[model samples]
Target: MRILSAPLLPLLVTFIPPHVTRAQTTSVVLPFRRTFSLSVSASPIILSLPAQNEPYWLSVALCGAILPYPRFFVSNESDVTLPGPGGVQGSQTGEELNLDEGLITYRAQMSSGGALAIWPSSGAGANWTIDVAAIQDDFPTHRRLSQLPLLGDTSATRALIFSPPFFTRETQEPIFPNYTFQDAIPSVPPIPSSAEPNTTLLLFPTANANATVWLTNSACALTSKLGGVMTTTATRTVYRDSSGWRRQWFVDGLSASTNYTAYVIENNAQVSGPSYLRTKSDSFPCPLAHSIPYCPEVSYAVPLPAPPGSATSYTDDNIPQDIKA
Candidate 1:
């Protein structure tokens, strides 16, 4: 089965501070305010089932935190009633949502099968609210607290993190051939003239094969002579195990408007080809503070076409006996 997910919300507000104050002296006082707010919004929880229908459940990771524990409520806008811990109704009565450690997930079952899910409206605002009086004791004695600043409403910022509704892993069928014997190397993109010192190189490998990938200005020269002039400032490596495929390199503090290249070797053997990439230049005026540096535009290599005559090897098994003879 194929599962696709996308980030439901782009921005997520985590903490909400209430207003508080402390008097330092007869004439002096300090005021404390909430820097951020916590909001939760999710796409309708969905569960798609096969022909043989069976009861299924929807599970989502909950993200938010509060100093004093706050009650959480899950409203089932649908006609069905959701079962909760201790057989409680869909909504829990008090401030039960506490975001201390990291991420928390919640699960709810559907009475009927066939792709059950929830559709929370975008910018619907915070689904849950907290009681300021209940958490007053946990407030800092020295520091003051106040209502969180409102850049936007709570619902406007809360977003789904892990399982976005727009993610898809369907691999595109290769229009070209595969390099069975040849080494598949890494390639980098060009750097713009206005780049930052902390540039990120995104490397996308074809197969989930256990290979050694590196960033070097030297190796790239083998394919393109211009790559040789570039220098290798950093290196990173990733191993493809049973879990999944991923890029292992993240280079920071790089020079601006500089040319760079990346190399990929399968099992220590240098691949026949390498990729060339460059960093953007830093000619534009800096944003915020003049001394603060900005990031540059990054470029990445496109997937190369497979070598010719490789089709026979892959389709050899499907060929007819008469045709093969």
Candidate 2:
């Protein structure tokens, strides 16, 4: 009889009876798929405003795009004060004036109409031109929206026509920061995780709404002291992958030989079915260790599904065979 070398003990361990570990756990996770129904409407335009001393308001329409607070300017017009109390540095709404560029901005409560009202100091009129432009996506941080390309038509020859003051008589409305309007509610559900310890999975939601994921030991139920939860309060970037926009999150430090149930919530409403996964027993060794500290001697067998009609149990003969002895 031949005795295996001490160096080869770990290698020989691979050929030992396969039942030394727990039964195999199946990971029947399905990928999450979601598509957005976007309706692109013809872009609307608002022309130039009349440079006048009287309070002048204009109603600019946004064709389905999220309109941010707008900024107004007086081309070649200076030494003119905006409407409101004397010595006010900016506009009536307390917005600062871009004097270098002859621009005045309004950070008031406004709606989709983008109702913009402005009044110059008495006798400040004629030849002077009023240029009104608004930002899209409600992303005020992106100053580029006030510059070229994204700034749309800024040329004097192509200035948009603003509706005459009181022509629409629009009122100040509430402001929606970073608001988005979709044709329909999206149904991006939480995907199931693999049946492995320390598993991380990707989650996707239909809208950029406040989202959360809840994990529980009980299927379809949230039991205190036996569950975990995570939430996304602020807006996050949605990655475009083969399965559309998705976000990844890790579930680590989970106990081996455990069952986990996960679900999704959008804006405080449950939006997905209970996803389930079972972890392998701690006694079972992972096919591949993430890292090895010592000289690696063991060459584990490649894991494969059991043959059709084969018993779930693995024995010395039917276990996955190693590529090398």
Candidate 3:
């Protein structure tokens, strides 16, 4: 998300000749599919005021292209004072500036006065300028409505304009931090202790760019006994991946028949939901053992005797019977 450092003011100036010899009226037609380059010195521009207890809105209008969905974002630089009312009074610093860049499907009516005002809904003031140019040399062929009407000219020309100069203001309020965890899964299936030993576990989540991961044993008896438990292991690194796919390795030291739970910690302290896994049982016989104790030197050819007066159950001729001779 891009944060606003200062307000962008208009720069381009155009004079339109009156069609009816009346006072020349000005209309702005924002071009579609154009790269807008705006440069403002930090000293002159005013940072918006922090939003207080209420939500703030920033509105922007587009003439050629449709408006975008409403989005809210906080600025990185804050507490900036610009020349304004009351000789520059200090306001909320470093608050989020809500922007409503909604898509404008309907074109501006040429007959009606052609002036679109783009401002924040919360009325937080900002100093910024917009520069618009055609996306391509040729404009879109689709015809909808005529462009903004100039005082005397019948046709509208593509150009950039700025809102009337205004003071930057913002409401101040406590903002809560938000986080999300995602792409969490077991790295590998539970493996036997005696088997070829490289098993691992992994998890991922969407967190701030600087977020970190923490692993904890959720179902451990000690943790259950105590209301809160310290994390058994933790790893911290800058959040390089936005997909949140983090990985950790679990080498072969786990005990048999033991269940373990894992979790991801983001942004240093925020904890994610726990995932459960169990170590392979140790009770199962080790396949490497050579001696067989249950049936010593047992032969596969041996057959069992049939029940008395019952159908022959033994298929082999040499049936093992009690030696009573």
lDDT (CA) for every model shown?
A: 0.24, 0.25, 0.23
TM-score per model over all chains: 0.21, 0.19, 0.18
What is the C-alpha lDDT profile of model 1 across 111-200, one tens digit per residue? 332222222223434452211110112322111112111110001111000100111223334455763331232222333323212212
Q: What is residue 22's positional error in candidate 1, in angstroms? A: 35
- Candidate 2 regions exceeding 4 Å error are 1-240, 287-325
Error of 1 at 108 (Å): 3.4
TM-score head-to-head 2 vs 3, winner: 2
Candidate with more favorable, higher TM-score: 1 or 3? 1
Model 3 lowest lDDT segment of ten:
149-158
Q: Which digits, one per residue and each the tens of the lDDT, describe model 3 over residues 35-126?
A: 22112212122223232232222222221111221112223232222212221222223333332221122222222221221221112133
Q: Highest lDDT among the candidates is held by which one? A: 2
lDDT-better candidate, 1 vs 2: 2
Model 2: lowest-lDDT 10 consecutive positions: 147-156
Which of the two candidates, 2 or 3, achieves a greater lDDT against the reference?
Answer: 2
